[model samples]
Target chain A: MADTSETAAAPRTHVSLQVNGTTREVDIEPRRTLLSVLRDDLSLTGAKPGCEMGNCGACTVLLDGEAVYSCLTLAVECTGREITTIEGLSASGELDPVQQAFIAHDALQCGFCTPGQILAMKALFATNPHPDDETIERAMSGNICRCGAYPKILAAARALAGTQAAQQ
Target chain B: MNTFEHVTVTDGNEAVKLLSERGGAAGETKIIAGGTDLLTLMNASLIAPQRLVNLKAARALRYLRFAEDGALHIGALATLADLERDAGVARRLPILVESVRDAATPQLRAMATVAGNLLQRPRCWYFRGAPHCWLKGGAECFARDGENKYHAIFGASSCVAVHPSDLAPALLALDAELLINGPSGVRTLPLAAFFHEPTNDARIEHTLAPDEVITEIRVPGQPEGANGAYLKMMDRQAWAFALASAAAQLSVEDGVIQQARIVLGGVATVPWRATQAEDALTGQQLTPELARTAAEAALAGAAPLAHNGYKVPLARELVRRAILRAGSVPHP
Candidate 1:
């Protein structure tokens, strides 16, 4: 437990989270969300806190290769599951294909929603390597880009779909 | 968010035992499967519980399969994304897929469970963010006369908030039943009986007791050559709740309707099953004029609030479209 004296009414539990392919331990209350643990505790700030509600997908992350809203996910419930963040996308020190596609298509402005958007696309590509435009739009509809960069984002996703189809 | 002791239960029996042992006070202990709605409500300081029983690890309650009787059985913990991407559901009962396909975002669909979606609280702005509202034990519903563009048009008792789940209406149309497990035992109830209008005495929605938990949802197969359609009209293209939606299932033979079910969503406290509309369609020929008449019958008793009169027309049009689509009737 991190701070027992601060709140004697509630006790904190030790939670082991696998973030970015590494196991990390943190003692926190059950109320702490996975987004808070990722940003404040582990210093993996790639997952931004946008609305804090599930309405906005700014805190999107991959849990067992499926994209889910981390803000709505409790940190205590993520044991034994593979968690991947935006930092994990480029673990090889080279920009992943989705990241490269974003840069090539100019898919972001102000860049607050870029990481969540990219990770959402990464999860989509994991399952459907070559998605059509409707599938791509439906998959990326969760991540809201405030800068009105949807056309470019769609272009980036379409490009990835095209390249993946070519490789196949 | 208020801190609560988190406990993990592997199955329904353990969860029931924990609830019974913990005294099973609705305000004290809460059950969480996906935490998509509960966590949000807690974040807004709506309903605070002392403990949360995590049911995500209940592997026995996370399945989706069809029984030999042609009924599709879905575990309570099955996610909306799981239903959307399921080939069997798409083939056997496509209305379920259509209902959940655009209900929420991709991330939310991946996280929200079928039970949570059915048991989720109302999305009325006043009910959600207001300090005092009738649904939350307040004296009056603020949305009754204020900012009620999204409130209910039908069945407004003390609260005007509308039901938010897109899957409930579709399930009700398919004649779904729930298997509820409690300390007493497991009992099955029709999906229609599970929901009721909120009154001054009963401030909450749904009929699930404090100690009871929904284990499974069984949707019986439709009639032979039956088809259905779910149409939702939202303010945005996606990721927003429905302003008004319609789910219509019909079994037609020789261009005549043999059986029909019409359920409307986002227009009432519960999934409003239009029996009049169903009666109007039964034994009638599939035609655009008949569809319009059925749609009119569905909204005949609607009493809309001042700001939400638009929902009546919107819902009527959706009902008409859903009926036409379900019967494969062409409309100009």
Candidate 2:
């Protein structure tokens, strides 16, 4: 905040983030995006930079409990928000229901898109434990699976929805 | 992406002041609302601002509310997902929801904001990845002659790039108004006149001053019992920009069209209003013959470039189908 008019490469700002229930601090260039920081700085390579743009959701992460494209998100913009990545999903060391369902249905082929797809489904089920086919389709549309494992993915989603409904 | 300093501002006044000082000629300083579009531009090196003004700390600008006058007041930072999931907005204006639901994927909607969507640059490959284009202060538009499939089919003068927002057409059909905060203080303008075809000096879309920031968008409530529909034809089944889209709103009084507003997207440099088609529908019954006649009127002055003639028929049919869908008429 000192040099308001410094046009050339303003000094980096210190950013404190609560990523995956753990506090982390970093002093990086302001131009760095959240996806770059998570992958490069923090060694959290789960969120891949498929497009490095908003078009591809391979870098999807939950920012403040809502799913957002990390590649499009500036790291400095996410100062106080809670970030949940694929590596943070299984805190209990047991496979989450979505992961279990994905494995049960063999929802992944090449596995490049699994982390993003799983995180997207995790965010979907957080709000809607039992989603219909259309809801699942709309929610997962952002994460593209180049392997074309959509049928298996849909089966996994349906299986998770059934389990949630039966428990309810 | 070129390296630049990022300045975070907490208030609207501060943001505008910083922008005015640093955002000089040729976009030296640029404002970051949601970064959904800006980041992509920077990533491709299409734009390299000297300084980036991040408004993420301006929490006051993030809101969606219905005012006492029945006008919907949407702040600049209100994300697409916020509009799509708002119960009141959904009940009052399902057309907005429909416009956003099919726009980008779920993650993109969560990151894209109202003002960002409105002010986003075109998705033209030439304008984006190419070294120079007329919109970027270059000599000519590449899409005018080369690979112009997704280019404009109407109202394209020097540049054929189409307006890429699905929300702009929907808002324009509802006659929305925009409030801008700039060096001269706050002023409001009708959204229709806010957008213009690319002029010689003003090559970019929209007439916002470099210092001005869109603060709020106000949509007056639709006429009682009015119905609206949005139809988009995309290249793929999901996660793609519109090849052609239509937004139609009509009010029927005893099976006769009382009022109509028809606007087409992905066919023009701006959200094009099919005023002739709307006029043709006024005081007419919802019939297949009338729809075809109005659709033909909508595409009357369409001048398509190479490889984009398909958009003329696609937009024409969308306009017709959207009108019928808005009127709740079953397909004949």
Candidate 3:
């Protein structure tokens, strides 16, 4: 249990949330963004904070299955929402299809932004399983790979989406 | 970012009650809806509120629907992604969808709300930086004589920062009204009249009082045979703010323009309504020549600052192209 003080200089709140299909709780300052809390508080550092602003998608996460910038989302506001980060993309220690495709297509180099990119691609597939190249490009536009690995990233997305379509 | 007390409100009335109870002249209590813009400003130390009233829990304020009166009613908490995907918005108000489609990237659209987009601060480098400009209670505006290529070319009341919302000009072109909730009561105002030019009060942007909150936005239905379009020119293809943008809505009958509204963005302190351009289209046959003339008329009164003379021509071409596109109706 955390004491929420009204007159404290740094106001704190007790937020109990479901992250990666598990219940988690933290007493944090109100100004702490979800990205900071995920990385600093709970040690879920898969979501990188490249540009603290929303311009960079390196801090992307799924809030209740909707893709949002974790950097701009307040930790307090996500008290009851379900958050899925890159670490939670797979179940039972197996790689998610998007991660498998990334490895198969060499979708990353330097690998700093790989988690965010994989999560973004995972989100795209969640909504549109067979997204075309254009849809993939538009959906992934927010996630910038500074290493210029866009060709591989797009290839990986196409591979995953194609597999879904072929299976259907 | 300065630490602040955070309290989640379940509804508009509760939010207003809290604000009215603890609000002061210095804006000690601030509302946080989407936090896409407010968080950035706080991280930059531009605004330091002692308390934040979080409205994300107010699910009542998150909706988009066409009312019985044929008006499109959007709650303040509706995300830009919600508007982008609504079939009615794409059909009845395609221009609104287009305005938001290219403004920010997908992730931002997912996080930013309608009210947050409408209330976001200017993207001016000077204002966002550490300079205590006129908008920040300083004596003079740094962009008035400084690097002002992206600053205002019209309606610059001692502050040349351009209004940054892509949805504002489009909504104004459609003649929308904003439903506001304050301590006194709920009231509605024309969207065009809602924005105010910067004055001695360095703490406010729109006409919203410190204790007031925008609950919903109502856009009147367009006339039959009315078509609208929005054109935004950006520095790059993705994730760039507009260099200049234009929104045009015109009602045409039998190849003749009956009514027209033209609004320009990224070149004014407010959304600049090109009355001259609208006037040029009324009661006239739609022609490329008329659009060019209307485009010229649109910039007839522009007073560009130091490095933004290029926006005059850019805005002119965008208005002309937008008018032509809006009036490009199939023959009956």
Candidate 4:
């Protein structure tokens, strides 16, 4: 017979995931969100949970190579999927150009919405290397920084766009 | 908050099977795609459905491909992020893309699906607001009597929540059709016919049966002289619904109008198609005067509520601007 505590505990199911190219399996509640799965279950806390809803981009991550809101996504559906968090963007303590440029431009203050902002920039530049100011505005308009660092954020985006294209 | 049950289906057919087998004839099931909308409703302790079926795994509902006839077929599960990123959508259906671009933030867009965006509940202060409203089957639709500036200006005899889509109007102007799947199998209907007048049915937006799911949208290729555009007037540039918006499509021949369509957004219970406006443009010359006349024809029968009387003129201005823009574009 199962233990009495186990019987009363919320039922947890096993899910196989590949985060940043490493395969791992973990047990989680069916209703548990991928945000919690990343922060709590996997101990990859790079992705923050500022707004449990999708309104805030603090918990944005890449699912199967496409950007998605981890907060709104259920962990159960993430099985057999590839996820990329801020932690995976760099290899061996190196900085991705987008993240480095954001710092150089002073694009952040509170630093809470930084991970998501960087990820949004990464996702944007990955597809569009040379987006104009208008395209950048349209793309980054969804991620908000209450600190009003938007001007610097725009500058950082332009700098990264220029650098990313030069290397191409 | 109550813990709701969840079932994930792997394909469109499986989703239909679950709806038919589990929902049965009662038709009280709720379908969830990204849960960007349904979860918000559930988290807020809104209507509690008997069962919640997840369609995120339905491969058939996640594509943005073209049909053999050059018409675009967008699966219901295609995310707004996907829509904005597609070169095809930007090149051929910028009006539709413009609608998606203006809604929500990039984070929400990445998570929100097109079908969910269209089917999402109203954001009326009385409804999403702390207090109860009639849309949730309350005694009074607060929008009827209070803070109704954003309410409907036409076809809203009872309730006044404005239609919240920027793309629906443009899509309607393009004569898009939905491919729906219910227990009875698949069927299709034009987008204009999808929305019902409040008098027709105050409780529902589309004609979709409770057990049905929108599988794909069939938007025909642009005709010989097609030109389309969307305009939205909102308090804020992001995350807010329209104050009043308009979408126009016109085809010209030998400097004379051959075909035209106009639909009003954020001013009705549905993407309000303007038949009178179409009639006014079908045989007229592509002139600023003709566009103004067509604009007047579009708002001829508007019945705006208190505090929203300006919608009639706002709608007229947007209609005129949209038509002039469409008329000036080189025929595609």
Per lDDT, what order, best first?
Answer: 1, 2, 3, 4
Local distance difference test values of all predictions, in order: 0.90, 0.88, 0.87, 0.79
For candidate 2, the clash count comes to 0
Better-scoring candidate (DockQ), 2 or 4: 2
Query: For each candidate, what is chain B's TM-score?
Result: 0.98, 0.97, 0.96, 0.93
Model 3 pairs whose backbones collide:
none
Off by over 4 Å in 4: A1-9, A163-168, B23-28, B198-202, B329-332
Q: Please tell me which predicted candidate would have the highest TM-score against the true structure.
A: 1
What is candidate 3's lDDT per residue for B1-332, written digit by digit as tens? 77888988989988888778743444688899889899889888898888899998999999999988788999999999999999999998898998999878888888889988888899889889999888888888899899998989998488999999899999989999999999889999998888878788543568887788999999998878898999999997788888999999998888899999999999887788999989998999998889889999999999999799999999998998888888873322
lDDT of candidate 2 over A1-168, digit per residue (tens): 111122445467789989999999998778878888898789999998887777778888998878888888888888889999988989779878889999999999989889889999999999998898889999999999999999889889988888534533
For residue A165, model 3's alpha carbon misses the true position, in angstroms, by 12
CAPRI docking class of candidate 1: medium
Please give, for residues B12-57, the per-residue lDDT of candidate 4 as tens digits.
7777777777436533467888788776676566766556688887
Relative to the true structure, candidate 4 reaches a TM of 0.90
User: Candidate 1 has what TM-score?
Assistant: 0.97
iRMSD in angstroms, per model: 3.1, 5.2, 4.2, 5.2
Stretches of model 3 off by over 4 angstroms after superposition: A1-9, A163-168, B329-332
Q: Kindly report the docking quality category of candidate 4.
A: acceptable
**Least lDDT summed over 10 consecutive residues: which range in candidate 2 chain B?**
B18-27
